[model samples]
Target: MFRTVVMIFFACVAGVATAEDTRLKRLDTGDDSRGWEAVGRLDIGGKGFCTGALIAPDLVLTAAHCLYDSLSGAQINHEEIEFLAGWRNGRASAYRWVRRAVVHPEYVYNGKVSADRVRNDVALLELHHPIRNTTVVPFATDQRPKKGDRIGVVSYARERSEAPSMQEACRVMARQSGMLIMSCEADFGSSGAPVFSFQDGVPRIVSVVSAKAEVAGHKVSLGTQLEGPLAVLKAALAQGQGAFSAAPAPRENRITVGTRNSSSGAKFIKN
Candidate 1:
């Protein structure tokens, strides 16, 4: 299938991450209007890459594969890894770093038993100190949006196709797939960008950027499917963040983690 599976979420399937596409609409990246913050500035062999986010003062989330590299079919060294927070405008707030990172043990990047086959492209990062100004983690339940819901994307992407830049808002064309409808595009540096949906005057992060764009290139945006797989993720995420503190989704809301209704006009993508 030519899919690049990441080992954080799915078990094992070869070639399951990318499709054959690329031409996606770009969102405006003028000034990170949505206040998208980059997770870290990596010096990977003198080259930089993107990483997780501090949705709360102490809880950080990102694609598990980024830290471990379970998809390139390559071996990675873990001891020399580092994480930085509040990375923006070429100057990090000067006070952000990760004390510990726990990659999902079952994570797979490429062709191992723990292959990056499913693109289980998400993870939780715990910080040494809680971010001062950061409040509650702004994470929404892991679920795909309805076919035509309005959504937002915030990520630390490489600008000019070659530098780390953050994207604030981009209309998610389809609720679950297809292409994004903005210029604030993403790149290798923009994995794990939180995708939020606007509802009841609040923007809730319903998904995270998952796989690489399909070959058609419209920029396929895969939101997290919270209904079934989050049990493992929740437990994995709670190892240090205490508990997932998301408010119980409104009863009228049917897209919650464990529910059996879709009358609210909100539906969940199957896991």
Candidate 2:
């Protein structure tokens, strides 16, 4: 039973690829980033980047693993973080520093990869200022996606860091133990990428990419089920736990969480 369970759970890094493209299309132009302005790059202390989405004018949601160091297991200072909305070719619709960040308490940084870990691999970031640009409107989030539900993803990954990409036809393969197995291709730096369901004809975040894995030779993506973990993180932020309030620790050059090794040769920081 344990072997079977493990087999069912250990899938791999999948990127956001559409049926039409079979690979992610870079949103390198204003036209490409049109409705995806809110999906931006979370530049972490100039060390690495992760994909994040603005859920509110001041709140960015991403994978919890983006908050820690993969080598030292230390929490990355929120002050060193910046959000570049609609980042494209050295430009952005808006830029803001992070004021506070809260990871799910249950999320163990640098912990072993597993379904339980993936389920809790979510975080919320509060920006120092709210982005009020008309073009960078925040996105709405909804309930988790069901099995086989068609979904979409927007993210930034290695070699594609200058801009984001959109994969409009990924599918949810299964849901088990609070983790989502998706057909979407998630590469390194894709951690915290939002999984959207277009059930209502409008995009709504349904999950946050946690890791990528492979099962039975089929590549797949892993993500955290959002609603519950998001709520917990919100409450934690309200209580001022883990918020960036003091001077950050001395900086050390190391691989950022979620960018180490995966199908795309990218790290999976959400673990």
Candidate 3:
């Protein structure tokens, strides 16, 4: 009976992706979403987009504004950017690519300020050469997992001054609203991190880390649901020839949460 139970336990664990009981640092209590990748720098030779996992190889999901011209509402600017998988120093070399970028048609920056910021702060770039590296964790398509749901997040962000020299946080956090906002402190460079939920044993992205803000003097982050963009990106990824493509129209864009902007403070419903 013990052996049978052990086997069943292993089966259940296998059906669910592994997650750590990641400790909470100086946090006000929130979910931990781990879906992050390092693409290129964030300036001229620097910035383009911060990458995160999407289901398969060749496709990378990120912010829409990363690819557009902030001023013109034109098209993608950067030609080639490096995609680093697992993004460790010596283990794997970064993948270089001329990209294929797509932004949702509904993505529009506020015309008053910059066109691109409103253009849609999300995008999917298909690599010039398919990456034969790293596991491409799939996304949760359209379903939004509930609060207190354990989620995993991974990212290769700005390495600050420390022995680890890197600011990397894994483990999971409680979810808030329809959005999964974590108190994980990410910098400007970590913008497009993928937020994954280890549900039914597979790692699936439920949302993409979209913004960070100060709420009541505490740091908090937010991600729009993955379903909207993932649907469009999947269809575009299958195509491979366009600069950009999106799913059918009437797509509900991802939600926006912050201190005083769209959403009020966040709350989780115990399930």
Candidate 4:
């Protein structure tokens, strides 16, 4: 599915050969995960999960597809979602329930792998309460990086779902139709992971993981550029598009790695 999508785009544009990829380092200990407390795991409907990051004390940035059910093509109830900030080894720096969620208006979840779907596959999640922990500072976002630029990714995935892993260096292989093809390692449970660009030694978000794909037998991750879509999501939130009814009290035992279901919404590209 992804191969066909990427191949179509690659035929029209040239992509740089991937540079030496960086190995993922697990952040299992506090010392290793400090300053990265904003990246968390999103548990959805007790059926699966995805990666997410806090952009504001109350807003989380993730892929739009993460808010839907892959099997039914239906939006999951916001109350069924929870954000476990800086989740690692059965604990989290902060826990919050999703009070509201807003997907990009242009994004359509038709269960297809297309540039249009991946381009607008971004979402903003509003937490019921802000995370005011001093250690879990929210991350700021920057404009999208260019092709061949060095970037990083911190995400929770299949085998390492209990902890987040950082791939300190990866290259943007190509940019086409508002989508990015990156050499970062991503897999099931890695959707909505924040793609970071370190400028002057400070990390800022530039893209959101939409799906994982293969190009010429090489594994690559798909991402959405944040400049326009983020603004749209914020505007929708301000206009009360994300508002929801009263939510139930938060729970303590909702942290788990996302398991693959019928559609693998946010994680995999379907044919």
Residue range 68-111, candidate 1, lDDT tens digits: 43334332332233445445454453244455554444444442
The residue ranges of model 4 lying beyond 4 angstroms of the native Cα positions read 1-9, 12-16, 244-271
| lDDT tens digits, residue span 1-271, model 3 | 0000000011111232223334433211112222223322222135333545544566667655455443444454445455555444333233546466666655653222111222244667676777554442345443655644655445444442010112224432334333454545455455666666666776666666555533333344556656765677667657654553223223233433333433324321111
**Candidate 2, position 131, lDDT:** 93
**Per-residue lDDT of candidate 4, residues 1-271 (tens digit):** 1112332224422344565757899999999999999999999879889999999999999988887766666677878899999999999999999999988877877666666678888999999999999999999999989987899999998888999999978988777768888888788888999999998989999999887876656667889979999999999999989864343322223112134321212223344
Whole-model lDDT for model 2 versus the true structure? 0.77
- The TM-score that candidate 4 achieves is 0.86
List the candidate 3 regions with Cα displacement exceeding 4 Å: 1-44, 69-78, 90-94, 110-120, 134-142, 160-178, 237-241, 244-271
Between prediction 2 and prediction 4, the one with superior TM-score is: 4
Q: What is the lDDT of residue 201 in candidate 2?
A: 96
Q: What local lDDT score does residue 130 receive in model 2, on the 0 to 100 scale? A: 94
- Ranking 1 against 4 by TM-score, winner: 4
Q: Whose lDDT is greatest here?
A: 4
Give the residue spans of candidate 2 off by over 4 A: 1-21, 245-271
Sort the candidates on TM-score, descending order. Answer: 4, 2, 3, 1
Clashing pairs in 4: 49-258
Candidates ranked by lDDT: 4, 2, 3, 1
Best by TM-score: 4
* Tens-digit lDDT string for candidate 2 (1-271): 0001122323332333434444678887778789999999999998788999999999999988887766666788889999998899999889999998887767765445655467888999999999999888899999998887888899998888888988887788777768888888777788889899997699999999887766444566788989988889888878887666443323323333344322222223222
Q: Each candidate's TM vs. the true structure?
A: 0.57, 0.83, 0.60, 0.86
